[model samples]
Target: MIRQYDLVERVKSYYPAVDESLLNRAYVYAMKMHGSQKRASGDPYFSHPLEVAGILTDLKLDPATIVTALLHDTIEDTEATHEEIARLFGEEIAQLVDGVTKLTRLELTNEDSKQAENFRKLILAVAKDVRVLLVKLADRLHNMRTLEHIRKPESRRRIAQETMDLYAPLAGRMGMQGFRDQLEDLAFAELNPEARDAVKSRLDLKQEKSRDLVVRIADEIKRRLAAVGIEAWVSGRTKTAYSIWKKMERKSIALEQLSDIYGFRVVVDSVDDCYRALGILHGAWPMVPGRFKDYISTPKGNNYRSIHTTVVGPERERVEMQIRTLEMHEVDEFGVAAHWFYKDYVENGSKKSVSASDELVAPFRWLREVVEMLEHDATSEEFLEHTKLEMFQDQVFCFTPKGRLIALPRGATPIDFAYAVHTDIGDRCVGAMVNGRHMALRSELQNGDEVEIMATGQQVPPLSWDDIVVTGKARAAIRAHRRRAEREQYVRLGRGIVEASLRTEGLPVDEAALEVVVHDLPASTLESLFEQVGRATLNVETVVRAMLVHFTPEKKSRRPKIKGAKVAAGSERAREDGTLPRGRPDAIPITGAGVGTSVTLSPVSLPIPGDRIVGIMQPGKGVEVYRIDSPALAAYDDDLDCWIAVKWDIDADEHRQFPARIALVLANAPGVLGEVATVAGKHGANIENLTTTDRKPDVYEMTVDIGVESAQHLERLLTGLRGLKSVSSAKRVYG
Candidate 1:
């Protein structure tokens, strides 16, 4: 059992004026309540809450937040209720406890929902009151620190994955570099054990041999700063396990081949002193070329500011050096908590404001942006995949015409730039000028490009624009546009289907008729009906039948002539011939057409429904329903035939297993393939083949063809596939 005195003593140290009597009574109540409880590590359950409260104290949160931390698990795992908490404390304290309590009851069906919705809830709760997030971060930090005690391999993997995807990124967003680094190290230790061990062993060996040399270097730097009448502190340390893993992957170097396994930090008194120290250090050791960054001038999007330089030490061994002020160092390690720690100084006599530092504010903005992108009803897999991509990004600093810096992810193009500026700019973007020169909207932006967005009133977002956009923000906007367009199309189609039925029943079809039929239904129900029609769930026949029963037509309206054409037949010969053109191919003769009838724009590798698309067509492949784009046929524009008017194949006697695409985004490890194969078998999936391709650093993209009965089967299989520790996304291959 954890001693009650320790919790009270820690609280007293932070808040000498606090009421110790209340804390002692609450401690006694908690100890008795959790007396029989134990953790996965077999520690007393009371220890967890006490430790959580201690962490809250370390973070310098208010007393209410600390108390909430102590009682967070009580209502969830014990007999206590929100009312009970409110009765014991006040409403504000109970509310805080409730917020922290909500973080635990997450019901995630898939990994994506587990990540996106959970984090979405977490961040929005934090945004309301930042302290809730601070305490939760502390709680997660401790859980990660002791994750190894969890016996099950699957449980360990899930926790590690959750840490990397949710907690670590959150810590980074909050500017808590120390906690973020430790969480990442712990996660890497569990998820990629071999890489973690290799990096740890190599770093240990380097530290064993170079400890004396590093100490001497630090001593010399301290002496030099002292002689210059500048008081400072210097320290040398090996990189964390996660940092080492990233470096090896980034440089594509083996552990034994890694050169810079250590870093040296110099903490000074002011920003000027930081730069002065950097200059002094460079004078002592030759600076490495192209290894200097002055973040103080242009801070990271995460709001971290420092001056970094790499230099050659005594034996010409490369040593990375970071210089910052003591205040910067404090913020660097503790993030926003440092402000609370020094709140007394700032409030009474110190020369600073008590508000959050810019670093704290900046990360919240980015985190909110990410949360917005993820909360668009995106599937858990997609949300997790895209969020990971965005979070793991390396920023590129581009400039607007006004010389304002706009930081974006590396590989982000001008389209992403326009979207970043505003949704209106993205919708109206026609072209762009980079550095006063015309450039393609898809051109990758580089550092320091003074880009000017060129737009026309006639411009609109293209459905295929998402294929070229790299950022999650841009993609979310594009998806929103697509959803709107789809809804509009369904509304029009529903109107037409309703009108035709009313006309056949001798009733004049009008808005009044629609109102009568939909009188009892919500507006959303009408919208959903239209969507169902668009997706071929409720066909025109079904809509007509429903309308005929509801309305009577008054007069006949002239109907357009229906074209009569033979439905093209499909055969295995079509697959073998490969005559169905796709992907930038010239027009070819379609044998099914009448003599002298022309067929142009034969899409290669795309299945056109009416044209008897064989293996040449794919589910997602956009193929021409018609050979050309026409304004009157807006429904069929942009590979119209690719939008197959699919109906229920009621007469089909057999359930066919069509080839569906399964992509695995996994950590490239030795036994990962075997593990994935085992899981696939467990989930009743027959993998036809698997092909692997390397993506940037540690992750690989593998494609596998699997047989599935329908979309639901595929969803279940993909869900199982993603449950594998390393797999990122699993979905059908739609072109």
Candidate 2:
């Protein structure tokens, strides 16, 4: 085990002001808290925190952050508490430790969800205090480095994938090139061992063969810079496994297609020297066409500044070169951590605002746009997935109509852009113009293409818009608009039920008649009433009765005084004649047996406009219509008409399906489904469904459907398919 003194010495570079007493106390406390706990590597668990602290120390973070790293895992994994940590250390250190502790304890539904939520929290924490993320990134960096100690392949893959998918991307976002490269390379090794080995072997062979050439070129560049009176440091860099994988994917070429795999960097004293050195390097070697990028003028989203160029060397071999200042190099290596030293001095000891890394911080205006996307009443999953597509996915830069730049993820369209502008515009979008040419809503945006959204004031969003819009914000806004529209529909439906009942009771309701009553109830009250009804609180019929009674109170029986009209005593004729359809009425024909007209026993089974219908006729009463398969009529044993006859509309396509088991058998040959496509083209059948299982030893089972117009057509196809080489069998599964 490493001693506390050695760890303290390692951390001293960042914290010369930190005394030995603080270090000793933290070490003892961490050890006490983690007593006898061992990692899967079988070493003491203290090694993990020591390594984490060392990583933070290398970043040259504050002493408190370093100490917090030492104790970060204590509270979560052991008996240590936040109050205890605060009591032992100062509040700042305790807060950081608690933040990390909370991060450690978070339970995600799955690794990806957990990681995304963690990243969200981590970024928020970083926004509050940048050091929180620094410690976390360092901690993740060390964990990734030591991932081999994990036993399960799945666990290793999960951690590696998370590192590759999230942490490495985050490191790139933070401008930590060195850490990002290493994490990606490490992840690649685990996730794709074969490709990793192949790239490694090829690069190693190339490096061995070109060792002398690299040295000579580096030396020449160093000498050229020295001659120009520009002090510089130059070194060669070998591309890592993940970088080669990315190159292979991007260029659609194998390892042999890659040249200039060996790159060199020239770090100088000043920004001017960086540019001067770039010019000198160009002069030394013939520049490759369109292979130069001056990031110094336009830094990357992560605040990385460099002038990168590839050149054909003396041996006619391509070599990539990067030129940057030493400060830029440090910032490239340490990312946001490097800002601490200079920013502290510049800010005069006060903590700098989140904007301190303005040059380094990725534009979060996109996040604000995402928040707006979520402003729509989108479900959590839809909102989260869409935001993930924008925030967590890779970014593509496009131009707005005015030539201003707008960055979105790959495959984002103008609809996403319109929504990003505002919800109303997105909801009303009718069309779009890409570079001033009208295109479909699904037209993918290309890099640097000027996109103009064409919206209309008269148009409402289509239901299909939910499927087409890609951005989370836009999808959410569209969904929200639809949801509010749906709620309004429900409100109208509910109001209609109440008003129609009032009219039948001789208290007719219209906009003019009900407007006063409606004005008495606010939207909040209406919402509450709906909620109560939805929750099965206040009965709908009772509510209707109360409203009618309130609007038109019951008056005492009286005789009307008309000119020369005979006066009569209190007449019960209208009330007792039963002309109204209150309970069960007479004279109206009931369709089925034992059913009444105008009398619905249960409101739970009320027939609406959209409902399928059935009728039941009663002896003195009239026909009582009932919904098919209503739970309210389930107990009626003798009354068959109470069951009602109903059928769904033949043209209605509004069927919703739960999960169903589908079995598929793919052809047992190489490239068979590509084979099936060739075979399917022979037949006039279109594949409506396809699903496959994981690969087994030989034959793969996949469920596929070839749509047929009729049962005879399906049978004809099946009969012909009995022994057609790849078609072993075909069957339909009802489930």
Candidate 3:
């Protein structure tokens, strides 16, 4: 346990004029309130908050923040009241405590909706005062440190998973690298103990073999800088076990193959000295190609700035070096916690409240962007899904035509760029010009490329756009628009159905009768009632019964059907070509919708626009489109109500790409894969994915997924592949 005097002294060490009395009072209050309350670990609950405060003290936060950390859980777990805290301390301290209390009460569970709703609250509360997040992070870190003491394995794993998903990434986004690393390592230990232990053992054995390697490297770096008349400090850094494990998973490499594991950091006086040190080091040793990045000129989204390079240095070892100024070093190590200045200044004889500066907001741009997604109407699960998407991606920085920088995920497309700029632009995006040349909307954006989005009111976003866009904001915007479009269609369709039923009964669509129906049902408005009726949640007969004077069960009503070909999908009546006929008034005409997380094309069958397809409505998921004759459709055959008739709405002149798959057997020879890529490129198709399996020692069997204009385009590409000397056989794969 941290003593009250020790806690105050620690704060006073950084802030000479901190309010020691306020902190002391809070410490005593929290301690007494948690009297006999115990944690799952059988320890006094007071110890948790005290340790959380101790953690913040290490971060060098303000006195009020420290006090808030002490009392964060009191309002939720104890008899303490916000009003009492406000009376004892000040309103600012009370409000800070309240904010953190709200976050603590949020029990983020395994359920995505509960977790996402809690995360939403966390973001909104932290956006008001980042200190709340700081307190919450410290609290979580302490809990994680003591996680093993809890008896329930499920509870322990749940907490660990939550830490990895939310707190760890949240810390990184706020520029707290140290906290992020610690949280990740702790969570990684719980989630994958064997993997973590394996990485640690490898590191330990390597350390045993080379006891002085890091020290030798650090000393050599310092000597090199000293020779150049640049006074500097050099320190060694080794990747954490979790970090190494993540790299191994990402690159599919083992610990023995990792070269950049041992590294050094060179910190100098100024930014100019940083470059000078870099030049001297690179000139002294052979620099590794394609391993250099200059983040000083263009900082990361979190405002992390450094110059990273890997080189063949001392003893011909593959060593990594990070060069930065002293200020950058402090900012990199401590992040936003290095600068927590809160003071009450008197202006015009009145106290003006001042917390963190707007400058702090710059590093947290990612947080604000996620919160902005709420306005786009994302569901709870979508909020969680998109937030993870926003958090876990390496960034590629690009520019607008007017020279404004836009930092996006590495594989982001112009659709993502447009959404990042503004949702209106994304919703209306029609085409793009990358670096002043017209590029496909699905083209992966490169760093430093200047993108010019060409949007028009005359164009609606194609369904295939969903496949290319990577950002959460972009996908959420697209889905929101699709929902609105679907709702409008349902409204119109429902109105027609009601009008037809009124004619059958010889009644008119009068306001009096409709209003009665609306009031008697679960709906609050005519559009709401119609939307329900159209979605089939409420039957047409149910609506008609509300207005009938003597409604009886003898008169039955059925769902209105659109007039068209009544032939069931996947039935023997389909065309001989196995393709549905083009123009149908009844069948819902649709273009190729991209694969979805909630609802998508069946994995067993990848259908192009020319294939006979049907839609299956999943309960929680939106709609799953599938090839009619696929074996996977057998599962849904008994339940015809779930089936929806649909047809491709492709125009003959439109050259949009649809997803298709092909299987290939190739002679195992040099340059065979290269030849396959060349053929794919020449046929105007993008090879989205390629997986290879070994048939025998001399043969390679692979599946290739390509985007093409239609089935004909795939046939032409197959013809080109069959002509290759390396390809033994090629055939379209449907499943």
What is the C-alpha lDDT profile of model 1 across 1-735, one tens digit per residue? 336787777777867766777677667667777779999998888888888788777666656667777887887888888897788787877887788888777643335555666766766677666667777888888888788888998888887888887778867766788889988998999999998887788778878887687888778778988888879888888889888788778888887886776688889889989878887888889988988888788777777788989988756777888899887787678776665532334446656524452334666677667667755656555565566667778777888888777878899889889888887798888889998999988899987788999988866588778888888778877777766665565455445444544454456556655555553443346666555543444543455455557755455432221123321222132124422212111222222221111111232222222222211112222112331221223332243222322111211234445455667788877898888788777766678877775675788897787665445667777788788777777665542
- Put the candidates in lDDT order, highest first: 3, 1, 2
For all predicted structures, in order, the TM-scores are: 0.73, 0.66, 0.76
- The best candidate by TM-score is 3
Write the residue-wise lDDT of candidate 2 on 1-735 in tens digits: 457878788766556656678878998899889999999989899889988988877787767787888998998899988888989997878898888776666544354555556555554555555667677778888888888999999889877887776678767767788888988898998999999998888888878877787788778778888997988888987878788788899889988888878788888888888878878778888999988877776565556778989999757878898898888888788877777642233366676523344543543333344445445655545655665565345545677767666656678888877876667788878888887799899877876678888877787677787787677677777777766664544344335334444544445455555544443443236554443332223344455554665676343222212122121111233123312223211122222211211222233444422333343433232224444434444454343322222222222242221111224465667766676655545555567667775456666777664544333444454555554676665654432
By lDDT, the best candidate is: 3
- Please provide, for model 3 over 241-321, each residue's C-alpha lDDT reduced to its tens digit, 9 standing for 90 to 100: 999999999999988999889878888999999899989999999999989999898888877889999999998888998
Error of 3 at 499 (Å): 2.4
Q: After superposition on all CA atoms, what RMSD does each candidate show versus the true structure? A: 15.5, 13.8, 8.9
* TM-score-best of 1 and 3: 3
Between candidates 1 and 3, name the one with more favorable lDDT. 3
Model 3: how far is 32 from its true place, Å? 1.2
Native-to-model Cα distance after best TM-score fit, residue 615 in candidate 3, in Å: 15
Q: Cα lDDT of all candidates, in order?
A: 0.66, 0.64, 0.80
